[model samples]
Target: MLTNAPSVAPVPTASAPVPTDSAPVSQLAVADALMSLLRDTTTEPRPDIQLEALTLAVSADLPVL
Candidate 1:
């Protein structure tokens, strides 16, 4: 069946600035975005072990496995 359907397009608002390829992003902004994304993801139940490993690796100036 052929029916007329209205197409929807996202209307950009003035409050939010759209990022462009040429736009320069700050390190803090990138880190914040990454942290925000990771915050919503599932993690191991024993986070303490993972945290301890990361802490020890950083303290020894060694790469995290």
Candidate 2:
């Protein structure tokens, strides 16, 4: 079963620019960002790791490609 879980955005550093928009970002967007981060963090190109991460992300109700 899939469920929507609360996601917390990463804090920006002092040099990072803050957004001017007052509107809240969507959960899907947050999930996508997190997925990208996870992919980038992988040192080697392993299909198994990617597949497992994708499966876990989907099962956790995170938007994944």
Candidate 3:
């Protein structure tokens, strides 16, 4: 089967972007990020890293700070 479809990475949705603000202290957002950082991935989110995330979220008006 010959196909002309060149596979390419999918684009991110509107909600998804490089966080430029602090993360909201909402129960959900932090929980989701925490899960993504801690259990599911090898990357353990350091406090410093979290702080940076918080900064971005704040910048984005995420109400995290």
- Report the lDDT of model 1 for residue 41: 94
Q: Compared with the true structure, what per-residue lDDT tens digits does model 3 show for residues 1-65?
A: 34886643222223343343483234344445555546545667557888788889988888763
Stretches of candidate 3 exceeding 4 Å from the true structure:
1-47
Poorest lDDT segment (10 consecutive residues) of candidate 1: 8-17
Query: lDDT per residue, candidate 1, 1-65, as tens digits?
Result: 34685532222333323446786455445556556657769967665887898999999999877
**TM-score list, all predictions:** 0.32, 0.36, 0.24
Point out where model 1 deviates above 4 Å: 1-18, 43-65
Best by TM-score: 2
Clashes of 2: 0
Greater-TM-score candidate between 1 and 2: 2
lDDT of prediction 3: 0.52
Candidate 2, residues 1-65: lDDT per residue as tens digits? 34685547643333232334785555555556666667667477657888899989989999987
Lowest summed lDDT across 10 adjacent residues in model 3 is found at 9-18
Q: How accurate is candidate 2 locally (lDDT)?
A: 0.61
Estimate every model's Cα lDDT from 0 to 1. 0.59, 0.61, 0.52
Clashes of each: 0, 0, 10
Q: What TM-score does prediction 2 earn?
A: 0.36
